[model samples]
Each structure stands twice: as structure tokens, then as C-alpha cells.
Target: MNENEAGERQIDIMVCGAGYVGLATAVAIKQARPSLDVVLADAAPDGVWKKDGRASAIAAAACAMLQRLGVWDELEEGAQPITEMIVTDSRASDPIRPVYLTFSGEVEPGQPFAHMLMNRDLNGALRRRCDELGIEIHQGTPIAGLDRSGACAVATAKDNRRFSARLVIAADGARSRLRDWAGIRTVSWQYGQSGIVCTVAHERPHNGRAEEHFLPAGPFATLPLPGNRSSIVWTERTADAERLVNSDPFLFETELETRFGRHLGAITVESKPRAWPLGLTLARAFVTHRLALAGDAAHGIHPIAGQGLNMGFKDVAALAEVIVEADRLGLDFGQEDVLEDYQRWRRFDTVRMGATTDILNRLFSNDIAPIRLIRDIGLGIVDRMPGLKRDFIAQAAGKGGPMPRLLRGEAI
Candidate 1:
């Protein structure tokens, strides 16, 4: 580590975001290359992650990466495996929403394709592993400015403390200031829809089954959780979603019940419903100079496929692998040429997923008779093809492309 004349603290790497991707990246790299110094700085206050009641779908490959990072054991107990998934398309008022497609089976012999895990639990687990790896975490310290014109990138924190590192990573969020500061452009647009998220308790078991109902407004997904509770991602027009979430308790439950159905039995809202606007935000470039963007900083897509977080995990895996390998070869991993490998490996997949979710959202979130008929037929055909279903399950499990060491359950 080297310090400049201005008293800037220097480290090998500086990760600007304490979200899962940032935490996982720090842990993955530090665990593999202990000699390298790594630090994480977040804008949020300490313990703020505990209040996130939201949960995410962790694909099989992401699960393996977390396990390799020594964080999964802490999260495994609370995680709920998704044994089956069924998709249906119909109006909200439909009495019988027929299942047009169903997916089941495992990528491996015993491991299911995906699992549901609370965001807080996953973040806590990753944070704990970071502590074990001796990574310094600075909370409430946001990046105020970034200067990459020198030999090393200097990140100025909100508190005026400067951190000089060989490489700076931005994993902040979709609207990333670090990404902008680095002069990285993005292609983005709002979907005019918002996803209303909440947890619901039911009288009967969900049997580890996940359901995605394609209503006129958008997809309503109920992902199974521990016990008789399930997590809901109900999409609707922005105005309608805002009104529903802010409306009275009785009204929210009544509206939620209409789409949630009776299969799970008498359902009760267990958490405060929150609505998040849906959109697609993809960075034009994942890296520039000595800076690299990860997680939402790189791309944000619709939750129609439940691959948002999984895609971020893919960024963590690929970035960590590239950085670690480059360091092993005694090369400056922060160089643009080195970072380009990461961008190349991820850009196509990110764009593909973004385009796919966009098409699905547009194709399903409507009442057009001709489009509905065509989509239903497509779903029916896919349902009948066992080979095609297996391929989809594998893709959803994060097994579509070249496997990274961490994602394949191997140490970097």
C-alpha cells in the first residue's frame, strides 16, 4: 500500500457499496488472495440492512458461489427451496387462471434450481464472512468524488477521507453516482409499472411450489418461503400500485387476495407492502480506466424472470475471477484491457436478459386478444417439450454460459 503527498490511504481495491454484490466481491477476492488489501464503503448507515423485509430468488449457481465464499451455511437454514414453478396467464378477475406452463426438476441430482432467501439474511451472512476475511467496512461513508487521473484512482468519501486504490468498483445501485462520476453512460427507460412487494401468511403449505400469474397489468409471482409464508412480487401500473400499497390494510389484502388465489388458503398480509418502479437500466460500458461497475450499477432489469439479483451475482463471480487471475499473473487487474475481459464476458448475457425481460413484460402485460392467443400457444408448446423445459430450468439455475470458478463451487 502506498500513500500520496495528500495523506490518502491506499489499498489494493476499494468496493463502493455494501450490498450483496459488493460484499461478495470483497469476500471472494480476499479469500482467494489474502495478500491483497480490500475495503468496502457504503453510503447507508450501519444496521440499515436489517430492515429490508424483501427477499430474492437465488439461483442454484449463485447459491454455490455464496457457499464457496463461506456465507451460505448461515443463510441455508432460512432459505426455502423452490421445487416447482408454474406459470399462468389471465385477467385479475378470472375465476380459474389455467396454468399454461410448469417447470420442475433439479440442475443437479438433489439441488433444486433455485431458492428463496430474505435480503437481510443474505446481506448479514455476507457481511459476517467479510469480517472473517478481515475486510474493513466503512458504513455511512459514501463516495463524494472519484479521481482516476493519477497512477491510482482516488475515491473521496463524504467525510473527506480519501482512499487510493488500484481499482475502484461500483456496486451501488441502478442509479449509481460512482458510475456517472466515472463517465460511464447507460441506456435506460421506465416501464411505467411498479412491483408491489410484501409477504403473506397462508393457512396451508405451499409445497415448495412457486407461481407466476401473468395478469393484464403484469406478472404476479408468489415465491415460497419458510413455513406457510410466501413472498409476493405483484406488478401493476405505477398509479394503481402506488394507490394499493398506500391504501388501507383491508383494501390491500382484498386486492392481493384476488391475484394470490385460494390455493394457498386464507392468506393474510404479514409485512408492509412496498412498491418499486420497474425499468431497464444497462450501463453502456462496465468498466473505464481503473473503475469497474458491478451488480445494479451495471444492469437492472424487470423482475418478470426473477433474475435481477442472480444477474448481479453473476457479475460478482465473473469480476472476482478475472481480478484474481490477473493479480496471480502479476498484471495490473485495474487496467482497462484487463477489465475489458469482464465486460466482454458479461455484456452479452446482461443485454440478452434485459431484452428478454422487456419482451416478456410487453408481451404479457396487456389485453390484446391476438397477442394473448399467440403467447398462450407458445407457453403450451413449451410446456409439452420436456427437453425445452430442462434447458430453461438450467438457464434459470444460472448454468447457461461458461461457468466461473466461484459459481461452479470452486475456490478462485
Candidate 2:
């Protein structure tokens, strides 16, 4: 409506792809700086996601991030806690090694490691917060074009609408078109495996225990959900995964049971099985002139560690804090000084997590005799060493890290 603002220069921040990171980033920034305008656009309908088909394991760290965003207090009782984790090398008929890790603590005096939440439920909660914060959302609109200069970045959506901003973050996803438009090259590779994710209802309760059964082909995991249901992440060879996903429910569940064993007792397919291709992707650089990459736009890693989403959340937290600080300091949020700081803060952590997950996948995705012996002993050693176990537990709880204030459940 104002020609001077658009024609001369404006400093609005546009977040493309209002999925997890996009929405999270938008709301985080709004909460941090109420005066700054944070806009999000996506190519889907805007709605509350109470019961979406997919579920993601939200780590304690991620939960803390949400709490800081003022979204956690609203999540329903659907967020299930994982009181225990059981890992086993499923090479032989019996477990070559079985390791159990337990944890019970709170963030303040009533917080607990993490919770199992439906993707929709979490998104729904964020959406409500966005509503309360007056965050602008442009849905059913995909960015179709872009124009950038030293002072401003412009985006053209599918609706033929033009939006301009001082900073534009690409949270679009692995096949991020925005990253491509920015001429940012990425290193990407397939894991030669695929993870089949689904929720199953079992005869016996999982007792809040999550299980990861590493076999020769790949890793199969069962994370506890509400009731007697468990979320399964079964990794398989690419070709086999395609076949299994295409197979009927009965056959698919049969194959799943074969690999899962009877640990959870008479398991029944409760939700439709889904297939996610395993892969690794790292953007050559995280920022361009006035643009920055967030979430999958920056990196994509194997979900074996359940750190993929958590990593994206970290990027969101860091980038939001950095930009908000720059605004308060009256500095150009997209200037090299700000962008460089973000790259430095995120690059190391992103690279380490990617490498760590890759190595873990390779090491445990097999049944090699030597590796089996070594890892089994390693597990037993950690099990016996309570101090070491506590460290591991804390790490898994997302306690020990370069945490932002929001991640620490503090107001930003």
C-alpha cells in the first residue's frame, strides 16, 4: 500500500515453507521481537494439524525450544514420554547385545527426555501460537520467482504476488527450489537405504520403552507412543523398501514382524506405513548476498539418531536470535557480519551431526563379527559405568550443547 516502503527499501523477513522450521522460525522471531514483521508462505492449506498421518520423535532439546516459543503448554496429552530406550544388535536369533538406558528428570522440576508427538499435533500447536502472535501466513502459494540486490530480496509466489524483504530464509526442504534459485550448490547422496515409518498397536504395552534393533540389512526402531502403540522406523535396502512399501498391508506387516521379532508382543498395524528415502545433503554455503538457508535447506541427514528435525530447530533458534539481535542493534540483518555469524555457529554442529549419523549408520547397519563384538562390549561397558551412562543420557536429553536461551526454556 505504501509506494515509498516497497520502492525505496524495506527490511521485512520472509520465511518460505511454513512447515516445521519455517513456522518455528517465524514464531520464534516474532516472540523475540514483536515489532519485526515475520511472514511465512507455503503451498498448502492453512489449518490446525490435530491428527496428521505422520509422527516425529521430538527430543528433549526440541521440546525445550517449543517451550520457549510458548507452544508446549498447549500440546495435548498426546505427547507421549519415552521413559526408557532399549537397543539390541539383532544379528543372531537372540540378541548379541542388549543395552537399556533409563532416565527420569524434569527441565525445572516437572519436565521429562522427550515426547512422541504427531507431526500434525505439533504443527497445530505452533499454528495457534502464530495466530496469537499475529504472524502473517501465505498458504497455497509457492515461490515462483526471485530478485535480489544489496538492500532487498524479492519473491514471486504462484499466485503472481510479489513480496519483498531484507532477509529471506529457505526452509523449503531437501529439494529446495529457493536454494537452487539462489545458485547455492549442495552435496547430496543417498544412504542406499530407505526408512519405513509407521505406528503399530501391540497386544502388550511398550511400557514407555523405545527399542532400536540393528540388523544386517539396516536399523529397525520402535519408539513408544500413547496407549499400546509404537512408532516404527525400519530401514531396508532401497529396492526392498520400494517393494515393501508397495506391498499390501498384510504382507508389509508380516515382513515387519519378521524383522521386529516378538519383543512387543502381537503387534498389529495401526497406521499406514510410509517410506522415507535415507540420504545426506549439505549445502555448499549457508548464505548468499541477502539470503540464508534454514532447516532442510541447509542439510539433510539420516534419521537414525532422530537429530534431523532437532538440527533444523537449532538452526531456527540460532538464526532467529542472531537476526533479532541485529535488528535491536539497528544493523542490517542480512549484512555479511550477521550472516557470517550464523554460518560459523551452525556449520560446525551441522557437519559433526551429519558425519556422526553417517558413521553410526555404517557401523550398526551390519552384523560384522568384530564390530558386533566391539560395539556389544562398548554397550556393556557404558551400561556398567554409571557416570558415562549419565553423560550419554544427558547428551541424549539435549542438555549438553551450545544451547540458545530459548532452547534452555528461557524467554528470548
- The lDDT per prediction is 0.93, 0.80
For candidate 2, the per-residue lDDT at 15 reads 89
Clashes of 2: 1
> Evaluated with lDDT, which candidate comes out highest?
1
Tell me the tens digit of each residue's lDDT in model 1 across 1-412: 4677889998999999999999999999999999999999873687899999999999999999999998888899999999999999999898999999999847878899999999999988988888889999999878899999999999998899999999999999988999988888999999999999999999999999999999999999999999999999999999999999999999999999999989878999999999999999999999999999999999999999999999999999999999999999999999999999999999999999999999999999999999999999999999999999989999999999898888999988
In order of appearance, the predictions have TM-scores of 0.99, 0.93
Error of 1 at 207 (Å): 0.5
Candidate 2, which ten residues in sequence have the lowest lDDT sum?
A: 1-10
Residue-by-residue lDDT tens digits, candidate 2, 93-160: 66344554334433334555778888988888887898899988887778997788645788877877
Give candidate 2's TM-score. 0.93
Model 2, global lDDT = 0.80
Off by over 4 Å in 2: 1-11, 47-51, 92-97, 100-110
Off by over 4 Å in 1: none
Cα misplacement distance, residue 350 of candidate 1 (Å): 0.4
| Per-structure clash totals for the candidates | 0, 1
